[model samples]
Target chain A: MSYNKRNDGRAFDELRPMDAKVGIIKNALGSAMFRIGKTVALAAVYGPSELFPKFLQKKEEGLLRCTYNMMAFSGSGTRVKPGPSRRSREIELVTRNALESVLDLSECPRAVINVNIELIQTDAGTRCAGICAASMALADAGFKMKDLVAAVSAGLVGDKIVLDLDYSEESFEEGAVDIPMAFMPRTGKIALLQLDGEITKEQLREAIKLAKKGCKQICEVQRQALKEKYKTEE
Target chain B: MGILIEDKQIVVPGEEVAEGMDFLPAPGTFRDGDKIVACQLGLVNISGRLIKVIPLEGAYMPKRGDVVIGKINDLTYSNWFVDIGYAYEAALSMKEATTEFIERGAELTDYYTYDDVIVAKITNVTKSKSIDLSMIGPGLRKLQGGRLLEISAQKVPRVVGKQGSMISMIKEITNCQIIVGQNGRVWISGTEIWQERLASEAVLLIARKAHTHGLTDRVKAFLESGSKK
Candidate 1:
C-alpha cells in the first residue's frame, strides 16, 4: 500500500493534535478519555479497595491490576483480538508498573487498584499511549500519586529515530523496531521499558531521550485536561 | 486558583510558573534552543520545573458520608446491586433500600429492579471491595419515573461548581429541581417537560465546555438564550 502524506507534511518528529478528558467514566474512581489524531483510548482507575484472594492481598501496599483491550473495530487490517492476548498481557504489565511507580500504595494497604484501558481507536504506539492515558485517569480519580506518569514510543526508521510512532510508520518503515517506554518525565526515571527489533547502543540512548521528550509533551496535555476538568472547584 | 493558558487550562502551585508565564504556551524557561516553544504546564513538584499535575486531595472517596446517584444493574434475593459507577456494586439491602421490611420471598422487581436509578450512600465498604449502600438517608431513595443522564465523572465538580454556584445558576434560570449525583448521573425534574429538558441540555453544555475560558458568562448566556421562547 502506498503511504499517505501527513497533514502538515512536516518531518517525522512532529505530533498530531491531542484531546484529553479526565474522569470521563461516571463510576470509576478515576477515568480519562484521550485522543491523538485518529487513535483514541478510554482509561478507568478503580482501587484502594479490598483484594479478592487472601494470598494476593499485600500487607505493605495496594496491588495494581491492569487490563488493556482493543475493541474489535478499533483498528484497520484484520482487526484486533476480542479477548486478552499475550500482547494485551504485556501491555497490562507495562502499564501497571508505570502507574505503580507514581502511586503511593502505602496509604491503602491490602487494597487493589484496577486500571482498564480500552482502545476505541488504534493508530500506533497503543501500549505507550495507553499507559499515559491510564496514569492520567488514575490522577483524575484523586488517588494519591507521587507523580504523573507519562509515556511515548520511538522507532528506528531507515537512519532516523522518530518519536511518537504512528501506525503507518510502524508497519511501513524499513527495518523498524518500535520501542514503547514509560517514564516519569519530571524525575527522569524509567518506569517500564520494552524494545523490539535491534539498534546500536547509541541509537538506543538517542531513542530514550527522544521518547522522554515526547512523553513530556504528552504529560502537558494530561495536565491541561485535568485543569479543564477541575477548574470550577473552589 | 490556577492559570488559564491560551484557552487551554493549567494548574501550578504559586511557586511554579509565574502569573504571566502560564497564560502563554511555552512562555517561560522551557523553550527549546533558539526555537520559539509553546506547551501547557502539567505538573509542578517542590523543586519547581514543570511536572505532571496531580489532583488536589479531597475528603470524598466513595465513603460513607457522601451522596451518590447510581443505576441498578441487577436484582437478587430482595437486594439490588446498583452500579454507582464505583469499582464495586453497591448492595442496597431490601431493608435499607426502602422503609418496609422486605421479606426474602418478596418480588424484587416490585421494588427497585434492574436498570433503576437510585440515590444512595455508602454504608460500608468491605476490605474485599464489597460495598454496602443505604437508600434511607435524607435524600437517598429510588428515582421513580425520571430519566438519568451520565456525564464524565471528573466534570461533575465543574458542573456543580464551588458551593453549588454553577448548579444554582442552572436552577435559577431553568426553574428546575436538579439533583446532582456525585458519581456523575444527573436527575432533573420540573413541572414542565421543556424546562427539565432545557436544564439537562444546559448541564451537559457545561460539562463539555467547562474547560473553556469565561465559563460563567458563557453558561449564563446559554441559559438566557435557551429560556427565551
Candidate 2:
C-alpha cells in the first residue's frame, strides 16, 4: 500500500476539525450545534412533555423520539428536499436508539423527549455528528444521563483504517468499508455499531480500537461544550 | 462486593452504585445481576441499608393529589380537557368542576371558558394515563386577572424554599398574590402593574438561580434593587 496524501491533507489516523456548542437555539429544552470539518448539524431537545397516537404510549417507560432532517441545500449535489427521506428516517432511528440507551426515560412514564437534528451542511459524518450533538443538548437540557453518546465513523481506505472519512473518501468509487460507531464514554460501552461493507476480522478489530480512541476524544469535546454552556463563575 | 460509589457522589445513568447483594436498591437505582446500578444521573443518597439517587434536574411526573395549574384546552358537554403542561390532559368533569348543581342544558361555559386558567387538584390518574381533576377544594379556583409564568418543573421546589420562606417573602415584599404550582407554573397578581412586574422579576430570578446557595438572600436583594427603580 502506497502512503499517498489524501485530498483534505488529514493523516489516516487524524479526524477532521470538530466544533460543538450547546444552547444555540432558544425555546428548546436543550440545543446544540456540532460541526465536523465541512459537515454541520444542529440538534434541539424538547419535551419530556407528551407523546401522541395514544395507543403507542408505553406504561413502563416514556419515549425518546427523534426527527432527523437534512436541509435541501446541505448536500453538494442538488438541493435535496425539505421533508424526511428514507435516509434521514433511518438516521433518526439510529440517533433515537443510541440516545435512549443513556436516558432515564422511565423517570417520566407517560411523556416523551423529542430530539430534532437538522443537517445544515454535509460532506460526511452527519449522523455521527448529530448523535454527538444530540447528547450534548440532552445534558444541557439538564437531563440526568448515564453519559454522552460520543460517536465517530471510520472506514477502511486502501487497506488502512482512517479515523473520520470526508465526503470524498466515504464515497470513493473503488469502494470502502464504512464503520459508524457510538459509545457511552462514561461506561466505555458500545451504544451503536454499524458496518456498511466487509472487512477482515483482524482489520475490524483494529478499526474498533481506532474508533474507540476517536470517540473518547470526541467525548472530551462534548464535555467541554457542556462546561462552556454552564460555565458559571465560582 | 461493596459499594463502588461514595455517598452523596453524583453518578450518571447506568453507572454502578454497588457491586454486591449486600446492599438494598432504592428509587433511582435498579438491580443488574448482583450489582446495583443507577437508572438516572443524580446524587447518590445513602441511608443505613438503602441506596438511592436524587436527580438534580428533569421534568415533573404528575401524580394523584398534585395541585397543578391547568389551561382549558377543549370543552364538551360532560367534561373539560385541560393541559397541565404534561403528557396527559387532566379531565375536569362537570360534577367535580363546581359544587353548585350544573343543571342539564346549562351552558358549560357559564362556569369556565376556553383558555381560562384554573387551579385544580388531580383526583385520579387512570390505567391508560387519563388524569381526572376537581376544583372542589379551598384555594382551588379560576385564576382571575393574574399573569402566568412558567419555569422548569424540576426547579419548583427551590422557588417555594424551606417551609415557604422564599415565596412568602416575595409575596409580602411585593404585596403580590403568588401561587406556585409543583409543576412549575406560577401565578403573580397584584393591584398595581409595577408591583406585578417586581414580583415576576423576583420569581424569575429565583428560578434562574435556584440551584445556587443563599438564593433567598439573593432574591431579597434583587427585589430591593428593583423597588428602587
Candidate 3:
C-alpha cells in the first residue's frame, strides 16, 4: 500500500505530539479528552451504583464495564461503522481489563462503574489512545484506584523501531508489528498486552524492551495531562 | 530459527525483560525475529513463559466485596432499581432491604420513594451484567436530609484514599456524617447547619484537586479556613 511520511521526520520509535484534557464532560461523573498526534479519544466514567443481574454479583465489590466507539469522522479516508461492531467489543474488553487492574473495586460495594471511550480520530494507535483516555476519565470520575495507567503503541518498521505508530506506518509493509500495552509506572505492573504482526522470538525480546521505554515516555505525557487538568480547576 | 536472526525474540534497546527468560514471538505479529520497538514507556512483565507490558494511568472499576453508596431511581413490587452507571440498572430486592415492617401494597412508595439515595451492598451480579444489591448490613442506611455533591467515579478513590483516611478526616473535622454514593453522589449532614456546608466545600475541593499529591494537608487547611469563615 502507498504511504505518506509524517511531517516532523521522527525516528521509527518516536511518538507524535500528544495532549490530554480531563473533567471536560459536564454530564459524566468523570470525563477526559486525549490526543496522540492526530488520533484522539474521549472517555467518560459513570456508576458504582446498583448492578443489573443475570450474572453473579459481588455484594462486596463493584463491577467494571467499558464501551469503545469510533466516530464516523474518526478515520481519514473511509468512515467507520456508526454502531458497535465486533472490533469495538474487543477494544472494550481490552480497555476494561487494563483499567480494572488499577482500580480499587473493593472500596465501593454493590455498584457498577461504566466507562465510554469515543474515538475522535483514527490514527494508527486508537486502542492505545483509548487506554489513555479512559484512564483520565476514570480519574475524572473520582473512582478509587491504586494508580494511574498510561498506554502507547510501538512497532518495528524496517531496521528502526518506532514509537506511537501512525496510520500510514501501521499498515505499510516495511515489515512492522504493533504492540499496545498499559502499566502502573509506580508499581511497575502490567495491565494490558496485545500484539499484531511478525517478529521472531529474539525480536520479541527487543520489541518488549523498546515498548517499555516508550511507556515511560507516555507516562510523562499522562502526568502532564493530569497536571493540566488539575491546574484548570485551580 | 537461527537461520537469520538467531534467538527469534526481538528485545528493544532500553527495554527490560525478566531475568533468565528468553523473549518469544508476539502471538500473531512476529516474523522469526523482526524487531519491535517500545510503544509507550512502561514496565515489562515476564511471568512464566508470557511477556506483557502495562501502562500507568486510568480509572477504577467496582469488584466483588466493595462497599459503595447509591441513589434510588425507581422501585417495583419485587425490587428497587438503581442507576449504578452500568449498562443496566442494579436491583435491590424487598427481601434484602430491611426486616422492619415495610407496607406490602401501595404504601411502598411512601417508604423508599424515588430519588432517595442510599448506601447498600452488592450481593450478586449476573453473567448478562446485572447487579443485585442489599441494604441489610451494618453502616447501610437510607441517605436523606443533606446536600448531595457528585464527583468522578475514578476520583472516588483519591477522595477516599488508603483505608478511609481521607473520608474519616472529612467526617471528624467537619463533624458530619458523610455518605458517599458509589455512583458519584455524596450526601453530607451535620448536627449544626454550617458544619454540613463546610463538609460539602471540603469534599468539592478534594474532588477538584484530586490529581495533585498530598491532598490531605490541603483539604485540612481548606476545612479549617472555611470553618473559621
Candidate 4:
C-alpha cells in the first residue's frame, strides 16, 4: 500500500523542528548542540594544536579529524555500545569529508583540528544531525571557512517522498529509501550524499530537490546559532 | 559601493561583510569574487577603505615580538622547550635564556628548570609554526611565587586596556605586580595573598566583559568597591 500521510503528521515536503545552539561546551574551543525531531547531537571542536603520533601530521594543511559516537542509551531500538563501532567510524569519516572542503587550514600546518560528535538521543538521521552540529561547532571555533554545511535526510517512504525521516518513517512497513545529503548553502555545492535502499531516478532527483530546500532552512538555523554566541547583551 | 554589514556587527564565517570592490578585505576576512566575506566569527571593523573582522575567539596564533609567559616543559642539551599556549612548543636556547655566557656543557636547569614559568619574548616564528623565544629583554625573568591565571588570548588587549591603563590601575589598587602575556597567561604576585587575588579578579573581569561598552569605568568601579571591602 502507498503511504498517504506522514507518520508524524508532517507534510511530505516539511522537515522536523530544528533547534541549534553554539558555545555549549565551556572547555572546548568551540561547541554546538543540534536537535532535529528526537535526534540530539552535540559537537565539540578542540585544537589546531599539535598532532601526536607525528606521522599523521600534514605539512601543507591541518588535519580535520572527526569522531562520531552514540551514548549507551541513545538508540531508539537498542542500547548502543560505548566505544567506536564500524557504523560510527563510517559516520566519522563522512563527517570529516563533509566539513573539510570549506576549511582553510593551511596557516596551521602540522596541526590537527579535532571535532568530536556525540549523539545524546537518536531517532533517525543521526549522521546528518551530527554533521550539522559539527559544522556549527567548526564555525564557532573561528576557523577560516568558505561556508557552513547543512545536512538533512530525504527519502522515499513507500511511494511518497518525505523530508527528515524520523524513526517511524524510516521503519515504514513498506520499504523506505533513505538518502542523507549535505550541502554548502552559499555555493550550492554538495558536500555529502549517501543513499540506502532503492528508488527510481526520477524519484531520486525529486528527493534531492526537496532535501536542498530543507538544507537551506538548516543553514539559516546554523548561522543564527553562531551569531547568537557573540550577540551583545541588551 | 555598499557594505552589507554595519561596523561592529558580529559576523559569521562565509557571511558577506561588503558587496563592493571599494572595500579592501583585511585579516579575518577574505575577498570572494567581488564580495568581502568574513572567514571568522568576529565583529566587523571598518576603517577607511579596509574592512576586517576582529575574531571573538580561537587558539592563540603566535606572532613575533609578543611578550609571552611560558612554562618550561622539556629540556635538551642546548634548549628548553617552553609551552606558550600555542599549537607548538617554542625553543628557548641558552644564548637567549641569559645575557651571561658560560661553558657549552653547562646544566640548562640552573637558569630555568622543569615547570618553571617565565616571562619571555617571541623572537621568531617559522612558516612551519616552529617558535623561538628569548628571555634577554628587560622585565623578562622567571616568575616566582605568583599565581597564574589563564584567559582567552583574544581578551589580552582588554586586560591590558588602552596604553596599559587598565592593568596599571589594577596593579596600583591591589598593590600587586601583574604581567599579562600575549598568550593570555597572567602572572600576579603581591605582598599579601588577598591583594594577588584581587588583581586576578580584576583581570578576569576585564577578560570576561571585553566586548561590552564602558568596560574601563566598570572595572574601575569594581576595583574601588573591592578595595573598600
Candidate whose lDDT is highest:
4
The candidate that wins on DockQ is 4
| Residue A65's lDDT in candidate 1 | 92
Each candidate's TM vs. the true structure?
Answer: 0.60, 0.88, 0.58, 0.97
lDDT tens per residue, model 3, B137-228:
88988876877787755467667768999999989888998877655667888999899988988888877766565789999888888778
Better of 2 and 3 by TM-score: 2
What is the CAPRI rating of model 1's predicted complex? incorrect
Return whichever of 1 and 3 wins on lDDT: 1
DockQ metric for all predictions: 0.10, 0.34, 0.08, 0.71
* TM-score between model 4 and native: 0.97
Tens-place lDDT per residue, model 1, B93-135, is: 7778888777657677887877777789888866544678898
- Which is superior by DockQ, 2 or 4? 4
Per-residue lDDT of candidate 2, residues A1-234 (tens digit)? 432667689888788899998779879888899998998989998887767777777887778889998888888754357796787788889888899888876656667788999999988788899999898888777676666799989878766788888878876766778999999765679888989998999998888888898998888787677655434621
lDDT of 1: 0.71
Best-to-worst ranking by DockQ: 4, 2, 1, 3
Candidate 2: where is the Cα deviation over 4 Å? Answer: A1-11, A49-55, A78-82, A107-112, A142-146, A186-188, B1-57
What lDDT is reached at residue B61 by model 4?
85
Give the TM-score of chain A in candidate 3: 0.90
Candidate 1 docks with a DockQ of 0.10
The TM-score that candidate 2 achieves is: 0.88
* Model 2 global lDDT (CA atoms, 0 to 1): 0.82
